[model samples]
Target: MAPAGLLDAFWGYERALMANDLVALDGFFAPGPQTLRADAGGILVGHDAISAFRRGRGGAPARTIGDVHVRRITDDTAVVIAQTLPSTGGRGQQTQVWCRTTDGSWVIEAAHVSQPAAAIAAAVWRVVGSPLVAGAASGPLVGQTVAVKDLFAVAGFATGAGVPAFLAARAPAGDNATVVAELLAAGASVQGIAQTDEFAYSIAGRNAHYGTPPNGAVPGAIPGGSSSGPASAVALGQASIGLGTDTGGSIRVPASYQGLWGLRTTHGAVSRAGMLPLAPSFDTVGWLTRDAATLELAASVSVDAAAQRSLEPSFVVDPSLVALATPEVQAAFASAVAGLSVTSVDLGDPDELVEAFRVTQAAEAWMSDGAWVDAHPGALGSDIAARFAVAKGITEGQALAGASAFDGARAHLDRVLGDRILLLPSASSAAPSTTAEGAELEAIRGSTLRLTCIAGITGRPALSVPLMTVPVETTAAAPVGLCLVGPRYSDLALIALGAALMAPLVE
Candidate 1:
């Protein structure tokens, strides 16, 4: 016997199809500014193709749905293998993978309405999905699974950093880092290393060697940052959490784009004994997770013993800067702020602060990559080369000037942050479109470093939380993240504030 809601379910879906009777089938699809779309049948995206798929050879039935076995693929999505009741054929099989939406809907985010695609999709999806058992582990994190960025050293596995030469040059590490050792002792699991950009330098996650992690929520968008692997791993539900480092915006950028939560604590708050150094002053270990509370768990285990002093995320939002946010992002931010008594303030003259950040980052990055840059001038990407060149001409006078200016920024920071925290944008806007580095890239980098530089300059702790998002035609775009920064040794305080902020976000 069919369930009581059986007819209701069928009718609801059927009514949506019938509603398009007079309205063209294409009308149901989100509007396209006329970019051609090709269906599985290979026709251009207009009303014709959409209607054909719906009409089914001569008005037989809207696309058929048969009983395909449903299998959970990731924390956010599930894949079901079944047959499509075809209009022409006797029977045709398909796989429907449903991903969870913020509003608690599991929609067909990706449908491999065929067998071959489903098989390949299922295998690779699983790698990016759940039930990840650590392939490399002596103990704890071994069976308890954790996803590591390709940037970290793993004994047998090549550290590609998404570069072929890097992979070839690497005589793999003989043993795990002491951090990995600790995780093992704690009975945690170690998932395989995830992907990162070539050289682990770029803010965008495009890697010429290993492919970038697909946007977990968006179809044709970038997955921001160097620590991008762990963000995708957690977002896709493959691993409970992911580990990555932040120098500029490595960890937070990806976390912001993926709508996951991340925290870049005080510079010296975490140990860096074995991690690769990008900029010793700014390079800090951080974790990515689904929520603020889970983030606290990682912080407790990871922060340097002496650095784990009093901490709480003081509410801070610059309404002026917050207003410039994208409409959707603004809505997201506003929704997060509602019902919470956050102390808002304007951080005037963030200019000198941001400049100090540039001077310091470029100088240190030059030290980190300058040697390779000299031998392989042509090998360096133009954007990175441009940044390196800025470092080459920094006179001692300029460095001193930068230091003095940074001191001023610190004074301003001290006056403003007296027992209080300020909320700010993680990035100025939402995720940029699927385009290469351009005006959008320039704007994003400027805004990200500007806000991020505050913590860097003060050597304080900061956390980025994905409290809001804007819906695109087919999926959601990563929105402005609410960040909390506190004075040095206040890593735990920032975590507390993050915990405090969560209620207002979804309430």
Candidate 2:
């Protein structure tokens, strides 16, 4: 039997709907693809769509629900059935499946309306929402939809960073993130905030608090994190562009996994105002799109170009780093860049480079969230908790040493690639299986970061072009990204170059 309080809540929802109170009605549904509503007029899928429907429909016929029967499906789930007597109707029925979230709030996950079936079919959408509309202005991205990673604050919404506790505790943002505001000003409609790894920590897409966002690019494969949601959303066609933050390949890794065009802008190229901090030193705003041209369009809207640099066909390939790719990836990359002139460059030991970046990033991650962890012990996912525990061991001296090493590497790269780009695999391997765990997962993270950390260490721009696919056990071939790192403040040039390089391959 459903609780008496739940029955009261159901009645409250009925009142809100009857009154056509958009704000009050919105409170009744959960905020993701898990929420669904179907009615004779049309099916309104997702919270945003439902909200929009409510706003557009205006006042509905007055109706009174009676003879309500609520059945408990579980302690946290229930079904509500009721008789609806509309003021102008013959007969009607409503059924709702309600679920209780961790915060002990009841929300409608699925709903159905009948007896007016002849009137219309239900409008359906992938269940998700946190929509914020853009101003009515025409620009390059006027008709495009951009899904923002939850780390960036959208006005009137809270930054979740994929942690339930943090989300619950945070206040609604008063203003949009700098990048988000820029996109809106450029005439792109906001699609809704997408999930991210907790505090944008892990590179694996799975969130400890929230569930993993689906990787449409690779069936049964990881959707690389912490920008997982935006990448997955863009790849899945839920949105045309995905606005995300990249701190040590968060955007690049997910883009590779989802087979989208992802960019990690030059460090400090974009403002981070109103965005949650992970590792400030390595953090940068980036985005993903299905095609190179759209990627360039989004980049143009967001990037305030420091100076334009001409695209150079000659690229420096580090064979030692290229060898890090698995046989399948190696072959795909070789084929993808077959026509371009590539010259080998000695970038030094890859393992050492990985460690240097790791220690410094770990220290910074700890610096950003260590106090919070101490305050809310045991709230983090075990994997993240374990990583932070290790991070705590990184000493000040060690961080300094790591920084020194990174500076040396950056200087070396700057000296080597005078005006050319450095070409490498975006990740050492394709997206890992969802079942991958323990040492297996960590090993993948380790190998992947070895390649991803290069851009972070140098504070330069890096673009991941999904030019080929590599074999994975779960799927026939998982998409692989070929990374191109360029000089500092050369973000626009990199995007143009990426488009030029990818056009011949994907187009």
Candidate 3:
């Protein structure tokens, strides 16, 4: 729902952007606005001051600015996103974010400026993730109820890897995952843990341990998994955010289908002490939110263990922009990238990297669960059985060599990045309209993960920015997501980028 009279002031912001007048842009924000960044010291307090700083950039007029789009957040606050030319001299390719003021003025909240074709998936994360590091706030996130994923160890809830037997065998845990503890310390209430796919495997939102949560965003359509339950709850508006995990497309798939922001941090940057293992190498904890700022705030709490870390922000755009998504989905992502400040890079053909990931992941799945299967063969999904079977053929030498190859890839990327973020696809498509039991389900699941598996194999940091939504022409269901992928430990960078363009990304 959009705030009443939102468009009344949109032209003002448009004029300011067209004129590249930072002063007018600065005047539009609320006092004491929160701005986050990496190397730039994450949080920016004092709305007035932040505006002054943004005005200093003296950006040029955008090449193209999409029609104003607004969503109501409160009586006075209206979240706004628009596509526009980012620079004064450049052709159309940019995105903008703004919040409405009481005086009918719109101020820039954040802006992600980039080329039109590069990509514009502002940012995407997940149900919720990573161990929450300690924070100094006086319980800013308090009173909110967060639904935990199965992997997160919650003192009394058995960590069901979506396996019923695992739940029965594992005694209730004695401690909360770091994320849960931090949220608790911040004064938040932890609702009971939610369900996920078998060990966060499938993307259909179905769980062998917990029954599938109804898809609030798309009733009959699968709720997208492996963070199935968390996304389900958030879409239903039952929880503030759902804590989830992403080894491949698990988090983003659900978040996109559910029309939420999902973030996948650079692996190793966030601690994984209390979560169940999928691919220890690639698994990343994430969170879900309806909009970008909420997603950014969640990232702020975890990036650098609650504001202890920051990095100079940089970006990467793969030269090979293959058709990874449907025509409409591609169009949406393209519109999003146009709204950001992005630089292009060549990541080459992703086929090799993606296939290796599959091999490595299977081997790992078997190592983690093959033994479990031996002990409790009855408690498994056919997908699990199939995955384990594939793992059996992975030779120890192959696994070792594969591990080395993976490390080499990560190391190479680290050198290339020198701490910048890499933008990649969240999935080949948005939420697929099929059931775990549907005829085309398996193909759809495999198809979706094709582009996202690269991150999991390398243990790199990645986040999904829910930038644009392409409405399904065939159905009444409104829209699907466009996503972003960043490098390892670039969670905060991803947040800043996402926050900057969130408004237009989702609109």
Candidate 4:
């Protein structure tokens, strides 16, 4: 039989975990650099790293212990095997190695946890299957699986658009969207329809109807959205390709936050038939992948070959744009840029351009969804609702003025960036804490939009390459993408260049 004191210590540790008592939980773990804790996300080494993770994680999922089994390895060392019954309906297993210290107190020296695979994560996927929609028998994309953004039309499924009321009002699509059909024809099957920000309006991926998706790279950070679902699915290895859209920074932001390669195709280069529109003027089809190779393959089938163009190898850096990122991101960018062949140039005031883009985007958003929003009151979350309120009041004169300013900015950027690639940070910072809200979230969003609007205004292809890592309070390090903005119709070439740059570093 197992010693009484060891069992008592095990139950005490469980109590501390249930109560989320950080101090008590820390004490339960054998203190030193040799301590370890691991889960599906990754491993945490040393007591300090494990402690830091616990502080940031709001708490463990509520679960009850059952079926405890014990084995004695030695007089002072034992193993505890316990079954966990999660409230969400799943059986999990946890294994721990306990050792008695000189003081005669038992503590965990190492631990590992395994949870039952969920059929679907409600926050990331609206619907899923073993193979939701099968692909063709053979093609270049054979064996690849795709996560179609909820904004896309999949045959036999109604596009949810991340709002329950909107989803309830729609009918099942008779045919797949052009992009979805192209991917399927290329031998890629659909994994499932993933979630998005409501109406694809918000960049921050928190949906009021469905919960926010988890950031695959950073355990307790918000997943960048409106392409939030697909990005998360791809990052977590649930799908090989994340078929999404980038109206503003939807694709690039999430890619940067999740350490994936994302591409925002040139406007009008890929057909958007059957897809919901947030801002048609800027809306463009895109995809996210874990590596540059998969991203290239996915883009090859969908993008128009006739529109493909080659870009000059030369790269340019706009100091004004780089200044918009956080200090940590700025430092990482500087380090990454030092090794590359790049020229410094000024792109003028970013705030002025951001303001112009915001005004026009808001107007377009109102035109696309204002009627529905008015017809169904209280349909949207507070952040998007407030944005629509401002959009509702935009005068015709203001929209025209904003359009004129945006046109001028685009023309100027086109002339300056003729054939050279523009390099900048993909986001203002690494993913923000999930608990971040109110003005703090808005400030981060505003800063990022300034950097992202450059490509949005120019109608050029932009690729977010996971080339830099920045330190964060939540983890040892978080990835920040180095964005590459190429000339119009340079989507394919952009992907190739990114893959080449990433190859050496990954090797």
lDDT of every predicted structure (CA atoms): 0.62, 0.80, 0.63, 0.91
Task: In candidate 2, list every pair of residues with a backbone clash.
Answer: 32-127, 33-127, 33-128, 42-122, 42-123, 43-122, 43-123
Instruction: Return whichever of 1 and 4 wins on lDDT.
Output: 4
lDDT tens string, model 1, 1-507? 322332333334335644545243333332333323332322223333334334422232445556745565566655556565555445665444445555544443333334122211221121332433344334323344567776666555556555555466767766665555455455566666777765567777665445556556544456777776777767766676677788877777777777778888788777766566767777877888887766776666667657566754346666766665556766777776776668767666555567877776666776776776676665555665666678777777877787677777777777777766767667666655444346777777776777677777777777887766776443434455777777777776676767667665477
Clashes found in each candidate (C-alpha, N, C closer than 3 A): 19, 7, 62, 0
Best by lDDT: 4
TM-scores of the models, in the given order? 0.72, 0.74, 0.67, 0.93
Over 4 Å off in model 4, which ranges? 1-4, 21-35, 45-58, 71-78, 98-109
Please rank every candidate by lDDT, starting with the best.
4, 2, 3, 1
List where candidate 3 sits over 4 angstroms from the true fold. 1-138, 305-314, 319-322, 341-344, 415-420, 435-439, 473-478, 505-507
- Cα deviation at 406, candidate 2, in Å, is 2.1
Q: Name model 1 segments beyond 4 Å from true.
A: 1-144, 311-314, 344-346, 393-396, 473-479, 504-507
Instruction: Return the lDDT, model 4, position 181.
Output: 97
Candidate 2, residues 1-507, lDDT tens digits: the string is 786468778978988887788898989988864467776333455676566546644556788776888888888899999888877676688899988878777888888977643221111111244345664488888888888888888888888777778788989899989888888888888878888888888889877666666677654567898888888878877789999888878999999888899999988888899888988889999989998788888888767765545575668898888887778888988998788888889877889888878888889989998888878898899999888898889988999998898788878767877777889889888887666766887887887888888888888889998887976654456799989999877888888788777676555
Best by TM-score: 4
Error of 3 at 392 (Å): 2.6
lDDT by residue (1-507, candidate 3, tens digit) is: 655555655677667756777667555444443532111112233454344335433454345565556667666655565655544343342234556665665555554444443221111111233322222346667545677777888776568767777777988778888876766766656655677788776777765445556556643346788888777767776677778888877888887777777877777666677888877777788888776666666666665755334555566666454265677767666766675567876554566666667767877877777787777776877766666777878999888878777766656655665566666556656555433345567666665666676567556655666565664422333345555555556576666666766654335
